[model samples]
Target chain A: MQERVNPDKANLIAGATGDWEVVIGIEIHAQVTSKAKLFSGASTEFGGEPNSHVSLVDAAMPGMLPVINEECVAQAVRTGLGLKAKINLHSVFDRKNYFYPDLPQGYQISQYKHPIVGEGDVILDFKDGSTVTVGIERLHLEQDAGKSLHDQHPEHSFVDLNRSGVALMEIVSKPDLRSSEQAKAFISKLRTILRYLGTCDGNMEQGSMRADINVSVRKPRDDLGTRCEIKNMNSIRFIGQAIDYEARRQIDVIEDGGTIRQETRLFDTRTGETRAMRTKEEAHDYRYFPDPDLLPLEFTQDYVDALDADLPELPDAKKKRFVEDYELSAYDAGVLIASRAASDYFETVATGRDPKLASNWVTGDLFGALNKLGKEIGESPVSAESLGELVDLISDKTISGRIAKDVFDIMLETGEAPAKIVEKRGLKQVTDTGAIEKIVDEIIAANPDQVEQVKTKPKTLGWFVGQVMKATQGKANPQAVNDILREKLEVGEE
Target chain B: MKVDEATVRHIARLARIKVTDEEAKNLETELSAILTWVEQLGEVDTRNVAPLTSVVQMSMKKREDQVSDGDCADDIIANAPEVADHFFVVPKVVE
Candidate 1:
C-alpha cells in the first residue's frame, strides 16, 4: 500500500539518480450487468456451455443485422451518471476493422472519438486517510469479443462465443495517477462506486471487469515519455505489482542511457515483471469507420431524465450521509459504505441505535465472521434485526459483552434470533445483585487468604472479580461481578 | 489518411493476417480512398454536435442484486467444432 512519491520526491529522485518519473493511466473494461448482449439477443452469462449463448449475429452469420439492447444502453448511461460524466444524447457505433479467430465478425463494434459519456472524475481514499482525485477521459460502450481457450488443446484452439457481443463499458482515465498504488486505489474505489450504483458487478476475478494499464516514465518537468500498454490485468494486486516493476524497468533503462520504446507488454505474474507483447498500435491502424448497417443512436431528453430519476444514492452521497447523519468517522464511513448490501445492513442496524457501536460490530465482528466463512455480507446468516437485538441486549445489560459474542456465534450457526438463542442456552447475564453476591461469597470463602491480599493490594481486586466471573460462567455482568467481589473482599466500604 | 506499404503491413500483422507485399500495396490504395471519405467528417462542424457513443441514451437497468445459475450449457456448446459431454474438446494441451 505504499504510494508512489509525490511530484516533489519524483523531482528529487530524478535529479539524484538521473532517472525519470512514471506517468500512468488506466482503461477499465467493466461488463454491464445485463441479461443480454449489447447488439444481439444472446445471453450475457459467464462460464456457460462454451458457445450456447451465441446468437446468429454474435456468430457473425451472413445477412444478420445487429439490434441494440436497450438495457445495455441504460446501463451505460447509469455508469456515466455514477461517474458524474456528461451523458451524450446522441452516440454512434463505429466498426473497428480487425481480424482474429476470436472475433468472428472480423471487426469489433465500438465507439470511437465520440463516446457516450465524457470528462469525469473519481476521488479515491487510501487506507492511510489520504485522498486523490483521478480524472476520467471518457466512458464508452462497446461489444466484447469471444474468448479463446488456448489451453484446451496442444494442436488446436477453441473459441467460446458465449461472451461475444456482451456489453462492455470502457472507462478511460487520464494520466493523473503517478504511481501504481494510486492507480489501484482508483480502480478499487471505482469498483465500489459501480457496485453501489448497480451499474456493474465489478467482479474482476470472474472476468466481469479488467484493466489496461498505460505506463511511461519521464524526467521531472520534461515532456511526456514513451509509454507501454499492459494488457488485461484482472486483479488489483497484480496491477500494482505490474506497474511498480514496469516503472522500475523503465527507470533503469533510461538511467543506462537507453531510450524507452513504446510497445505493448504482458505482465508475467510468476516472475513479477513485464515482457514485450507487441508494438502499440495507433487508431489509424484499426481502420475505424462508422458501421453503415447500424444507424446512429439518438434519445430524447425525457428518456435521460427518466434514468436520472431512477438513480440510487451513489457512493459519495451515501458516504457523506454516513459521516454527517450517523456521526461516523471518515474511515468507518468509507468501510461501511464500501458495498451497497453492507451499507444497507448497517443502516438497518443503526436505525434508532448507537451508530458508533453498530458500525463497530458490523465492520468488525460481522466482517471477521464473514471472512472466516468466505461469505459476503449479503450471504451472512445473521440478520440485521437479530444483530441489532444482540447489540441492544448488551446495551441494556441483559448479557455481558463476552456472552453476547457466544450468543452471536450460536445465532450464526442456527439462524436463530439473538434473544431466542440467549434464552435457549441460559446465557443471560447475572445482573441481579443477589445472584452475583452468591457467586462472590463462594469465591471469597474458598480463597480467604487471597481475598485478604486483594484487600491490601487494591489492584489485586481484579483477580477476585475474575474468580467471581469464572464461578458464574462468564454470564455474570462484569460491573456487577466487580462490585460484589469488592464488597465481599471488603476492598470497598459498604 | 494515406496508408503506406509499411502501414499496411503493420496493420495486417496486428490483425494477425498474412498479406503478401503485393497485397499490402493494393490495400494501401484502397484504405487511403476509404480514409479520404471518412476524413470528410472534419468539415461538418461537429463542435456543438455531441459525439454519439451508443444508439440509445437510457440509463442502466438494474436487477435485484442476486446471483442465479446461468444454466445454458447445451445451447452454449452447440457451436463447438468438437465437444465431449458439456465441455468443448480439443487435442491434449499438455504432455
Candidate 2:
C-alpha cells in the first residue's frame, strides 16, 4: 500500500520547491563540418561575401536540381558514429514546406519519417562531479536557411544566401534534463565531444552550433503538460537563462489560474525574456513529404564502421584518461579537456614534466593571461615548450616562484621563451646561501630594534624577510632567506 | 485530427495569416483531412522505430585553422535593400 511516486517527479521536487517538473529537451543544430553545402557545391564557409558562395541550386534558380555532396554524407555518417547512434542504411529527405523570405526554395529538405541516426545518449558531468546521461532522440541532416537582415531597412528586408544550403545536423535530445544547470552542462559536454570528434566546431558566436530549447512545467505525478520551444538561442548562457526564465514563467502562469500555451517563442537577449513568436506548428502544417528531387540516402555498415574507427578520442574517454593517467583533479581535468586546444596545450607541457603543475599553469596562470589578452589557448603567445621550460626552471631552483612571474610576463609580451626572458632580464634566483645571508644580515643590522622584537615576537621576523627580499629585487631565494632568518632570530630558543 | 473553425482561426492568427472567415472554415476541413492522414503514421508500430531527424548522416565540416575571411564592404552592401556607399541604409527613426 505504499504511495506510488513518480521517479521523475521526485527528482524534480528535490531540485526545486514545487510540485512542478521541468521537462527539458534540446534540439541542437550543428553546422556540418564540410567544405561544401549538402545539396550544392557552394562553399560552406562562414562570414563569406554575402551570396558569393551560393551555387545555382542554392539560389533556387530555375531547373536547378541539387546534387548531393558526397563529403557531406560522409560527415553525417561520421557524426552518427560519434554519437553512438544507429545509422540507418536507407534514409529519405523530405520537403519541410514553409513560407519565409529567407527560404528561397519555399521548402527545406529535411528528414521526416526515416532519419539517418537513431536514439543515443550523452553523458554530462556537472560541477558537483555527478554524472547524468541525457538521451539523444535523434540526429538528422537539413539545409540551413539564408539569413534575413531585418535591420537593413525599415520598409524592406534583405536576404543573405551565404548560409543557405549549408548542411546542418539537428541533434534532438529526450526530455531527460530537469534543470538549467544540467542543460548547460549537457550542452558544454556535447560541444566538447563534437569538437573532439572533428564533427562540429561548436562555435556559438559564429552560428555554427545553436540550440532550440523545449521547456514544459508539469505538476508532480501528473501527465506531461504543454511545452514551449525557445528558438535560436545562440549562446549557452542564454540557453540556461531562457530555460530558467521560461520554466518559472510557465509555473507562475499555471499557479495564477492561467494555462500554458504551446508555442514557438523567441528569446530576446536585449530584454532577457521570451516572447511568443508563433503557435507550435504540427507535422501536417509543414506538409512534409518525400523530397522528389533527391534520392534515398543509403550507406553501408563498412562506411559507418570506418568513420567510427577514425573518431578521435571523445571527451568522456579523454577526460577519464586525464584523471587516471595524468592524475589531474576532476575540476582541473574538466577545465583542461573542455576545449581541444586547452587539452593539447596541457599535454605538450605535461609530456614529461609534472602533470599537476602543468595543469595549474594551463588552467590558472596561462588561462588568466589568455583571457586578459582576449586570446584562445590556440592563440596563446607563450609556446607550450616555453611554458614547460619555465616550470622546469622553478623545479630546478634556477628561478624562484616570485621571479618566474616577471619572466612569464616578459615571455607573454615578447613571445620569447621563459628561459631566454629570464636570461635577458637577469631574473635568475640568487639561491647562493652566502649572497642571501649578506642581504639578510644587512637588513637585520639596519633594523636592530625590529630584530630585537623578533626574539620575543617570532612573527615580527617576517617583516625583516620582506625587506630583505625587496632589497634583493625579489631575486633572493625566498626559502633561503626564510631559513637563514629563522636560524638567526631563533638563536637563543635553539 | 478534426480541426474546428475556431481552431483554424486561431492557427491562422498564430501563423500570421490574414484569413477571412470563409477561408478559415475551408482551411479547417482541409487541415482536418491532412491531420487524419498524418494520424495514420501514429498507428504504425513506431515505438521501436526511431524518429528520423535528418536525411543524411554527417558531422560538421571543418576548414583549415586560418582566418580566411576579410571584410568586403562592397560585396556585403551589394544586396542591401537600401545602401549608402559601403554601408547599409536604414530609415532614420530618431532625430
Best by lDDT: 1
Worst 10 residues of 2 chain A by lDDT: A1-10
Q: Which stretches of candidate 2 lie over 4 Å from their true place?
A: A1-19, A278-284, A491-494, B1-95
lDDT of 1 by residue, A1-494 (tens): 22333564632234347756778999999999988788776678788666777777787877987777777888888888888888898777889987666678889999997788888889888777777778889999898988777775667666767888888999999887887778888898899988977778999999999999999887766767889999999999999999988988888888888988888789999999999974435444677888866777667778888998999998889999999999999999999988999999999999989999899989999999999999998899999998999989988888988988888888889899998888888888887889888777777778878866876688888787777777888888888777666666667643
Q: What TM-score do all the candidates reach, one by one? A: 0.84, 0.82
Q: Local error of candidate 1 at A279, Å?
A: 4.6
Model 1 bad stretches (over 4 Å): A1-21, A219-222, A278-284, A452-458, A484-494, B1-95
Native contacts retained per candidate? 0.13, 0.00
Candidate 1 retains true contacts at a fraction of 0.13
Candidate 2's interface RMSD, please? Answer: 8.9
Interface DockQ of each model:
0.17, 0.08
User: Model 1: how far is A488 from its true place, Å?
Assistant: 5.8
